[model samples]
Target: MADLRTTNPDPASPYPLDPADVTPAGPPRAGAGVGLAVPGRATGERGFVPPASLADFAGLARAALPAEVWDFVAGGSGTETTLAANRAALDRVAVLPRMLAGVDTPSTEAALPGGRFALPVAVAPMAYQKLLHPDGEVGLAAAARAAGVPYVASTLASTPVEDIAAVGGTVWFQLYWLRDRGMVADLVGRALAAGCAGLMVTVDVPVLGRRLRDVRNGFALPPHVAAANLPGGRDDLAHQGTPGVSAVAVHTGAVFAPALSWADLAWLRERTPVPLLVKGILDPRDAVRAAELGVDAVVVSNHGGRQLDGAPGSAAVLPEVVAAVGERCAVLLDSGVRGGTDVLRALALGAAGVLVGRPLLWALAAGGRAGAEAALALLAAELRDALILSGCADPAAARELRTLIGG
Candidate 1:
């Protein structure tokens, strides 16, 4: 491994430390503007100026999208208590930086069962991406490929699995455990045939949570945007609902399997050739159980706080889950991860990597493929800065740093 640590340049140190010579890197790539460019139309042909930060990207997305589509992308379950908690919990963790330790060019590489990613970040599965952009999951997979990260394709994706897989990245399939076993098997076969590297079984949403925003918006898939992976085609995947009910609710009630249990893992395990990971785990016991059941990994998530309104934040429960299963299998995290520092915090708390949602969609909505690429690049740059400033030379070193909670 390369030594990323460099001599510190701070001269006011009691101990012998090199003088501070760190200078801010120049402006980010063409599309990614960090205090260098403003958000607007692309400057030249085949180029665009992305927002300076994820928040800015979100603002652009909100401005670009219709009210209903924005609500579907940003809203959480009823009351959004879990959503608030997720941000609050992450905010409570204070990063304790170390000085005099030489660190530069910090490596953010993360190893998954499929391959090693350039950063400890992956795109989480989100439904109906076509609602955000015409490229949908295919665009996301292309962005992931460009970023050297993984893309977890959702069962509810607007594009078919084969098309997404054809984008040529580390693709992971997220199964919702539909009510019909035949449909489930067929989907799995499609994903496998499409060359997905792993299977992420989402076990949290036995029933869709009551999303008030969607209800108020009378959210339903537009006639054109449909789950393209289903057997009966787009018509079968069309979500039907009334004014008070969300299309998500109606879809789940019709297809989501409520009787799924641990015993069913065997059936899935036997059907797939790739590794299996259970997503939406918060409890330490569940993490342990996943390990016992031969799961390759477990994501400490609360469905991005969209499934259960009162559930604990994924960040708050990450340490406990890590303590329980750190030795058995890889522990990834999702929900409430907003930036590079958040990614570092999760790694310090024992997450192998972090799955990012919402923000990527925001970027995609804002500028299509170029915007999404800029978003990933911005985070990669931020992670590098965070690692160097925190006196860590790599993700492994960041993980070894001491963390303070409730600060």
Candidate 2:
């Protein structure tokens, strides 16, 4: 049996990057470069440099993106309190580093539901990635495969899941679990047929959250980017459109579903044999409930703070959730995770892995596939450094390096 463990690299040690960790180790690939040889550039020469950390990526993305785009992608609900708090909470957790141990090559491998990944990080499911670049999810999937990480497929993906899987391997499906059961079934069937490794059913969103920035920007779904799972029809506007809101009137019915419940999990479980994961779980009690429901795993998230303005940061709630679940199933986390240190922090609290949210979109928008690949590479480097500096020889060692700051 494969070891369900993580190996940390030493920062101070003489450990150098293996060939797989570098850029030139693999073949040269282009991303949604829009007719150019490079992504986000007219020439083969890509202009932007992939940031080394979350902060670096944020600065680069801010400089590269428009105000409206950034707001729609990065902004949270109402006051954005939860959005800011996510980072703040992550900053509160400190790593108890280890001393000089004979360390050579450090690995950031993680054991996921279907298989393992090179790193404990994945790209979170986001909608309308084509808005960020022409290639959209296809480019992202390619980058994930190249970087040896998994790409979670969003129901709202501009690129069809089948097409994405064709371009890249090991795709996971994320469902909004709409009011139409048949639509959900069809998506599951498609995912299974496409060889998806797992199913991530997002449970928090019954209706769209109060994304003030999206409303202010008059964010409407672009007509070209349609949900491949749903049929094309305008008469079903009642299901797709927000009843009172005109600004969000054009979004697909796929975005909101008020009929979701735990009962529906039974129906969902029967649809696919793939490992089922419940996303948007923040409460420890809910984590316990999810494990009881026989979910293969649970992701501690607040929907990137895009939903529920006052919710605690996912990192702040991770320990409690972990305690509740008690290793019954895998525990994954998202929201405000930007670097390897964040991965280490989440792992210290018992998260099996972490997901990258808006920063990835920024990388895609700024540089396309190459940019996204570079972004993943930088994160892997950071994770390796974090493991080394923290004196964690492997993933199991992270359990020992954890230090609770308060009661």
Candidate 3:
């Protein structure tokens, strides 16, 4: 058996999606107040061909968004040593391939307790996607559905959870447990009502990190674009509620609790019925602890290298976490997964799946929903090719195939 979770144990299923799921929603419309105007270009004029690699997709998306928004989504904490290291770690793994294994087709499906994914990838939950494109999470949800992958929605999503769920894809919700238990329960209730298949509570940020870029940019939400669900007025740039931000010259009074402990996780666990996956796990000891707590899964992430400086990249720690977690719970990976080859490398290292960060926002900035879909479609194709070329006919084979070299 494969060490990590996969949608299909069978290696012969060539097509990932069932035929009925192929219909994609039309291009995304901008959300209210984004002031984004789509030019008068026909759908055909938008072009159907994507670049041969994700690097090219990234280039196109980079050219689309503004400098501040890009920096906000892309920048990491404290010199971004961890940020660059995430990609660099992936560069070190070697995927050893086999010759004449007779693998003509490859299967990418991996079954989960909730359902299966078209590929060993899911779009990680992110905040303020509308900042990248007006469609935001909704656009991403539709694209994931079309591509037969799952979409995990952020608690701070600009688009409401119900709206994103209505796109008819397998959906999960990520939570930032508030200091108030009532608020946490309310958020979990909201997600359950929205038809979320699972709940992932991110435990790493007992308090939001000291994000230097947000401080440097005075990254307050513009009056027109505040988080609608936040207690303070979503549109007020000057409103400071919990966490104090001197950078904006406005102290938001809201302060995320900095005293969270493992006992607090058990407290939060009592309120939700959905399967709970813990994000922000990098330590092997924590991974084992989470499994002992009977958590459904663990996402081995460094918050995309945005939280701590000089922390080990997700790649460096994935194998250890997977080993620690063992078969007790599923182990998913995130942080700087750039392409199909990266996906392959991660799976070989024993990741059940990988999450794509920043690049989706880049795609959204470049072309909204359509651009995001194009990027997903491109990766699916590339993953398929990688599976075949490596002589691994399925995700299970990736666990044993070791002849492929990494970048």
Number of the top-ranking candidate, with lDDT as the measure = 1
lDDT of 1 by residue, 56-174 (tens): 56666655565566667676787777877888888888888889888877788978656688998889999878787776778778999999998999998888889999999799999
By summed lDDT, the worst window of 10 consecutive residues in model 1 runs over 1-10
Off by over 4 Å in 1: 1-39, 233-241
| Global lDDT of model 1 | 0.77
Top candidate when judged by TM-score against the true structure: 1
> In model 3, what is the error at residue 164, expressed in angstroms?
1.3
Write candidate 3's Cα lDDT for 137-169 as tens digits: 888888889999888998777777888888988
For model 2, residues 272-368, the per-residue Cα lDDT tens digits are: 6889999999988888888988899999999987778889988898988888898799999898887788889988988888888776776776677
What's the residue-level lDDT of 170 in candidate 1?
A: 90
Model 2 off-target regions past 4 Å? 1-48, 234-255
TM-score of each: 0.88, 0.84, 0.84
lDDT of each: 0.77, 0.70, 0.70
Clashing residue pairs in candidate 2 (N, C-alpha, C atoms within 3 angstroms): 6-395, 7-394, 9-388, 10-388, 11-388, 97-390, 98-390, 98-391, 240-253
**Selected candidate, larger TM-score, 1 vs 2:** 1
By summed lDDT, which 10 consecutive residues of candidate 2 come out lowest? 1-10
